[model samples]
Target: MITGELKNKIDALWDMFAAGGLVNPLEVIEQITYLMFIRDLDDTDNVRAKESVMLGIPYQSIGDYKERPNMIGMYKTALPKDVAEKMRELLQWYSKQEKNLTTLAEFHVRYEIIHPFQDGNGRTGRMILFREALKSADVDPFIIQDDNRSSYIEGLKEYREEQKTDKLVSLMQQETVDYYQQCSYFME
Candidate 1:
């Protein structure tokens, strides 16, 4: 919740990125990585802004939220300006959705789109999705693994682009079946 003069300064920095046509998330990260390399090679290491304090929570903002401008393929995540409000809306909406595959997929999709955290958005969202699955009746929890990564991205892209969840729901269905089979095997 950075505000006042500090927020303005942060906004100015983002504006500079926009002015330089660095809208792509990967490009921005690349530029920042170079800056980090240069900083590592230099002796000017005492000038970091003291505003942010890391609390060892990957899914949360530090002292205040910062945007990393994340993207998945062509889809840019929620805008930096809308993070707080959108996150509020997401939580509110999350509290009321029907706890099933449709809602679960939709919830995961929306969370990925919102992408509130600077880092760990995907992992955090998947964790929440799995938890939500546990809460739902008859929906065995399953992790979104690297093996299903393409389908996961495709599902997200479909919903983001076309307002559809069939692919996502299908993926969840298969994952749950797999989870149940594994559980049965272990029990046997």
Candidate 2:
């Protein structure tokens, strides 16, 4: 039941996955489930909220010299020994910042850079995003699409290298609105 450009794109996707040793197609589905991250915002201290994202994970550090990769392997992560301090710094920074989209954007980028959790960094980081969205309006996850995928990465990189979060905040705000508009009708 598939053909044309869409099929081509799917084929390319399969090729990419195949190159990465992902033979089981179900793995793609599982990864997609992982992408369904983030949650609603609350007034409580979100520090623990983000920390609790990775249950049974360390608060201090993980290994003798652990360093995790970004989804795209953009740059190195915080040194293993520095994970605790870096996380503390990120939390302190988060506490002082406003509980809004901009702060959420920067906090997420910083959290990803820290790579606090041993294996669930993205899952945990994604949680912080939805919590903020939940605070103001309905939960609106970034709609999974080809464009959003690339834009999301660009937003992260912009934050990391240039220390600019405007692009990311804008993207999230728009994604919030788009997600609501596209999906809210089904709820009604």
TM-score of 1: 0.63
Each candidate's number of clashing pairs is 0, 4
**Taking the tens digit of each residue's C-alpha lDDT, what string does model 2 give over 20-83?**
8876644543344445442211222255446766686544332222454334375777766788
Best by TM-score: 1
Runs in model 1 with CA error above 4 Å?
Answer: 1-64
Candidate maximizing lDDT: 1
Instruction: Name the lDDT value of residue 46 in candidate 1.
Output: 26
TM-score of each: 0.63, 0.56
Candidate 1 lDDT (Cα, 0 to 1) = 0.71
Error of 2 at 162 (Å): 1.0
The lowest-lDDT stretch of 10 consecutive residues in candidate 1 is 43-52
